[model samples]
Target: MNNLDLIVVGGGITGAGILREAVRNGFRTLLIEQKDFAWGTSSRSSKLVHGGLRYLKEGHFGLTRESVKERERLIREAPGLVEPLEFRLPVYERRKPGRWTMGLGLALYDLISWKWNHRYMPRNEFLQNVPQVDPRGLVGGFSFSDAQVDDARLVMRLIKDAEMNGGKALNYTRVNKLLRNSSGKIEGVVTEDVETGEIKPFHAPCVINATGVWAENLHPSPEKNKHIRPLRGSHLIFPWELIPITTTVSFFNAQDGRALFAIPWEGSVLVGTTDIDHGNSLTDEPRITQGEAEYLINSLNHTFPGLKLSLNQAVSSFAGVRPVVSEGNVSADKESRDHVIWKDKGLVTVTGGKLTTFRVLAYDTLKACLDMLPHCNLDAISEPVFESRRSITLSHTVSETVLRSLWGRYGKETLTLLNESDEQDLETIPGTRTLWAEIKYAAKYEKIRHLDDLLLRRVRIGLLLSKGGKDYVGRIRSLCENVLPWDNERWELELKTYFMLWDSCYSPDAFQNFSR
Candidate 1:
């Protein structure tokens, strides 16, 4: 049995954030995840770190304000990882939210962040920027500032920071059940290793159930009438050349008038996200349905009629279940994105929030669990999310762009990763922003128990490249063989497993099979 001050029961952004905050506040924290880090909704997000501009139109001023503030903070703190992304919202004739309504909303969005970064672009100018957009209506558009991030990298960075501050984390570890004291209060947890099937007990007075969609399984919601509603948001990733827009294009779907986006990320154009109730079992990996895929494809064609994009052009598809607390009265899209914190004796459950406001969620969770932690410093909640380090000094051969990216992802470990890499390792993998050195570093140090964790989360080539980067398996294996302790038999098994998993969950063809 191991004793600790706090144990977080999830490895997504919310749980990672809690672990980092708790460790900084002088708590001996440990985070346990059933699967790979950010394998759930965190990694499958639309990859926007914005103020939820649509929320403002929905009258969620508080969420929009907090998200906007956090967006600015992340862009300032993590420059390369959370860079400013300009969004172009094309106006169409007889649209629900016309030009002035969007202009006022953008004005308020700018006002919340104290930056005047939005302007109305004429139709010709907008066409000059996004030539593929549908021009039948021939209306102008509004350009505004937001931010984007590597969702998995952000979660990994938070976990890495927590570990650096003496906190511990275990991936591929499942907390089977909560251990309770004689008085029926939560005391510890019984965890099972997903790979080895070894069960272990860890004692902690303060246990936080930041498990996102799976939170209710650990601790039921305090509100009997309200429950965690699993809403699926699916996305499609296409080759950049197919939908080559320099900036993010935000538009509304003509079929349902729902907000949709076409974002350029990591050398690919990401289009998605259909918001609908997820009816699949939570234990299985969420996949994009054929109906959802066709809906997204139709939206793309509606927005960019010139491109005439088809579903077959998408290289990959992914779906994630958002833990939305719902009263079961409104539609899935209308459900609130605000987080809820429930405390039952020693156990505190936190769920339902956006990726952009993870820090706020962390702070709020800590505040909720403050009474359980007597040694915690309240002031620590207001501290910077990341540690401020001295400027990195590296060889002149490393470009400023690569250095910034490495710093944002690895922080203090950037120098070590660079020092350990060969000259050729510094070059990025073809068709992706990830460097070959990242594979070696993650395999050796990032607790990669499986090949999917490396290709999917650590570097994200799995989603960026076709066939989940299957073509580069030989190169990746050569790069990581020395670092990873896998024999030939194990390597073959891992490759088979990874490719099977990718086909079932990530490939666009999966949707076709699923519909059949």
Candidate 2:
């Protein structure tokens, strides 16, 4: 038996962060993710590491402060991936929260977050005069800041950092069961490689389950461990030029407290997130039902008053499963977003958290795990999460915020794709929204063993565009032949698999579901 200090299950941001810290502290760390890193809800997030902008409205100020601090830290530390995002809230008639109320809400959001916070971005108030805000029903707009993150990129960087240290990380592998000793302490478990279907046994004293929605599979029932009510948040990407709001626009869903964003990603506008209750079955692809798409489209139209973001202009769509803690609320939207890390006899199961607070959650988990082990060092370090000078230099590499955006989230890890993409032409991958080198690099350093992993999680090629294209997938399939040793038959299968998953998860309406 190869005994170790810890084994982390789940390779989302939280698990990856803990893996990075554990290995840095010299713990013999092993992180096993059942699928590609961030393939679960982590990749499907609104892709922001914001201070709890909504939490402030709900008066969760403590959570906001911690999230704000972590957001800044991540932006500074991982320049290439996590970057500051400014959001403009356009006041419209009959919106749930009126302008005065929202103004108060945002002012409070800035008050706690701005405290001791370095000037990563200008304060929200300065952007009020910016003409980039849609001057439509946007009577008056209040601007605030959060973060825009390449959720998958950030997770990959963390995994790389962990590997850069001594931590061992295995993806596309599932943890079958938790090992137990005579005293019922967690001793690790059996794992199976997804590609080869080979099972292997490993041992560790502590096992952290960060498996997100799929976690219920690890235990007999999630109710037996902690409660996780799976909620699906779906997003729609539209052509960038249509209502190209330079800043993210947040509108209160008149139907519910759920919010929406018309924020820029890559070159398009991302409008999303309908919170609906989901279930036990977990799949890489979940289709967007007609009702959900209509709801989102209608909501955006209502917010912008006439952006014409109908199915005709829809480019792409994506969905995520949020494993929110079941707090006796019939509504998934009302479920608490706070996280809980509890020991179940021996297994340390982590549940219920958001993107903004992933770092603090990881730090707290490290402290608790180390305290459980007397000899392990959980010593706090004074190193700021990011280097300020490097952050500034990187952002200036492209435009007002390109390099800073890349370097902040990736740190030194940005070099992986930067070297490749820099040399290549700025061409979108055939059939997808991704640049060519990104997919090329994914095949290289990212260890994208399969196309589904590359298209969905590695490069977000298929998900970023408004119209999902079968033609583009075929083109990528041909390009991939230059890198992967797939036979023509296997190439077709990978191409079909990627589209099938997308279609299944987003609905089979062919026209509505196929392209955008």
Candidate 3:
């Protein structure tokens, strides 16, 4: 640790990406997270790896182009995890953006990626594709391609890949203090294990703060009035049976004219993303407020009047605070999604970027650190973010879909997971795309520190199931009993803690109870 070339804080996508790139360049790097990996905004995103189509409307064509390029690269390199998703934006008779205007935007969007994947669908064809859409004022729609991913798994993939390439990562390890030299220059960090309360210090020539919303805590903005604006974006997950749609349906909310989406993710329909000032402490787990829930529900009802979606129909809800850097003059959605880097001698704080451009953020952050680590190679950014794809063959007959998923999430570790798993573990979870084996695999290998880590971020069953997968807790415990180091009493305590967390943070009913 004393000879480390770099240290990365935060364990989100940005931190993980930086660690991976640093390791690829043969730098001795270590990444430490205050909580579980992706315990913050990374796990709670809208689950899109999309080129910010709306950015084009805001005249941020450069951001859109970078995101589009990254989106295409991820689709090519990580197939199963970052799979292609079709999006359909239905046009209304009185909507602000008419057909011609939307067509122009889509044309530019396609031109950026050099892919002609967008087309104007007539009302009849649009209805045939999305019958659940409200047809009252429907004037056809625009179809385009984007991508989706298991957000937490993507973070885990980057971290695991980095570890495989000779980097180290620690979860639930908090950096209590930044160490500095005589000239008031940062030199290293003092870390404390959250669970054990054990304190230790590590030295590095260059340290990076990629803590997203918490970046300001480690390194404040040097500019006047420029600060990290914590904007909370919340989402509701419903069973696909309730609001079945093959492609994502993006529409504008009549109440505020803000664009929202109802996307098909995993085995459920994810409707989200109300952006507003958080106005809450960063330490507390974010949850959907009652007003935000109603706002999203109203948008869904307006778009799919036939479905009549409600909060009660939703299986779960989640909220993540965006680390948007703002000047306190613009609306929440009007803020830029671009990342910024501030260097204070040996410390480089990189914050405020979209998930789609993480690699770009990583390269930029490392380039900022080049002055401190003269041995680091900046050209390594051109290399692939992940290891080359390996051909995985199993003795048992597993579906191509499942194998692809395992490869995308686990990479080279897929064969080991399949080899070490019991045959029964190969079965998919009753209500999720997650395999039962994944629970065991994560418990044994994914550095899981708690039951919530296993269910919530690792496999996402907590977000996909009703009552936060309460019914399957027994089976989950059985699968992970030997793998996790929890005894009976510890198991009971974990269950109590996990259910309490789920009830307060992840349950859709939590909003109703909170409103009371």
Candidate 4:
């Protein structure tokens, strides 16, 4: 058995962060994911790297402070992945915490962010930015600075960087059982290769469970490990033409008082996020319920009364189960966004945090578990290594927008990807800024075992297009068939499986079952 210093389970942002830091500090670290990287809550986020403006209202100053600082740091460290975003919070007579009150919140938000492009937009100025918004009873709004990110790409890039620094990451592999020494102190893990059905055992001094909502399963005593209260958050995406908007609009739902965000994303408008207790089988993929679709549609209709957005206009929908920590009968929305790390008979489970604060969570998890490995040098743990600045000039034929997009997605690898691609791969997909070369690159290097992993997780053409971007399936297969080495039968079966999964797990129609 190959003994390792650390074994981080779950390939979400939290585990990725831990793996990066561990390897940077000279610890032999291994990260394993049951499916593709970022296939869980990480990829399905709202894709914002904000300081949790809502958290400030809930009086979580500590979380807000850490998040804002990390948010700014990420913006500077990974400018290619994180872009500055402007948000507008429209005020109405019926809405509580009216204009002036919200203005106070923005002031605090800026203070927390160290500094921000915070300003109050008068009704006319706001209307200019969001013309589709219903100007009736609208008392202007407050504009503030945050950021948006390619959530899935961020995870993949972090893992890539970790690998560059000597970390090992495996996708399509799972930890089938936990190993314990005779004394019952933590020893190692038993893993299964999901593809080859091979079982293997490895020794490690520390095993960190960062498996989000699924953390409960690995506990030796399942009865005592019942902290997770899975909250399902669902989102809807629409064509930009139908709901044109330049900035994110924050609205408070009249029905449940939940905050909703309708933002412009990937040349489309993304409106989402409903938080409710998930009372279903946790084994299957999460889906947006019919009530969630209606709720989001109604929230958008209320905010942009002129648009009258309907459920049918939704190009696609997605849902992710949050591994929130809670007890008793508290409302799901009210659960603390803070994370917790606790050691058990042999394993350490870390869960309950937001995407914006994943780095901090990783730091804390490492600090908590380091003492367990007495032989390890404490000084080895340090800050994560940020990508170094590099200058590259591209061909004049490549437009500035495309060049920037490529760098943002590929970072240092942009040059190699561009140099290897033909002219056809340089062009963007019809409806999205993603390029054909991205699909090819993922197939060749990103461990894409299935068509869904390529379209859905690798490039996001699946979520960005209607019917999960089926129109481009033939083009994609042609581009990546050589790299993926899929036979015609395998390709057909994978395509069929991809479509079935998408329709059942990521389509607006998936919500119809919850309508009644």
Q: After superposing candidate 3, which stretches have Cα over 4 Å from the reference?
A: 514-516
Candidate 4 — which residues are off by over 4 angstroms? 220-226, 374-385, 393-397, 513-516
Residue 252 lDDT in model 2?
Answer: 69
Worst 10 residues of 3 by lDDT: 507-516
- Give the per-residue lDDT of model 1 (tens digit) for 296-331: 998899888888888778899889999999988898
What is the per-residue lDDT of model 2 for residues 92-184, given as tens digits with 9 covering 90 to 100? 546557777777777777778775322222233324533343344444656677888888877887787778767888888989878888888
Ranking of predictions according to TM-score: 3, 1, 4, 2
Residue pairs with clashing backbones, model 1: none
> In candidate 1, where is summed lDDT lowest over 10 consecutive residues?
387-396
Instruction: State model 1's lDDT.
Output: 0.90
Shift in Å, residue 516, candidate 3: 6.5
Ranking by lDDT: 3, 1, 4, 2
TM-score of each: 0.98, 0.86, 0.98, 0.95
Best by lDDT: 3
Candidates' lDDT values, in order? 0.90, 0.70, 0.91, 0.83
Clashes of 1: 0
Q: Which lDDT tens digits does candidate 3 get at residues 1-516?
A: 658999999999999999998888888999999999999899999989988888888888888999999999999888888999999999989787899999999999999988999999999999999999988888999999999989999999999999998999999999989999999888899999998999999999889999999999998898878999999999999999998899999999997889899999889999989999999999888888888989989999988998877888999999999999998888888898999999998999999998999999999999899888857567787677566667767766798899888889999899888988889999988878899989998999999989899889999999999988999888999999888888999999999998888888888867665555
What range of 10 consecutive residues in model 2 has the weakest lDDT sum?
117-126
Which prediction has more favorable TM-score, 1 or 4? 1
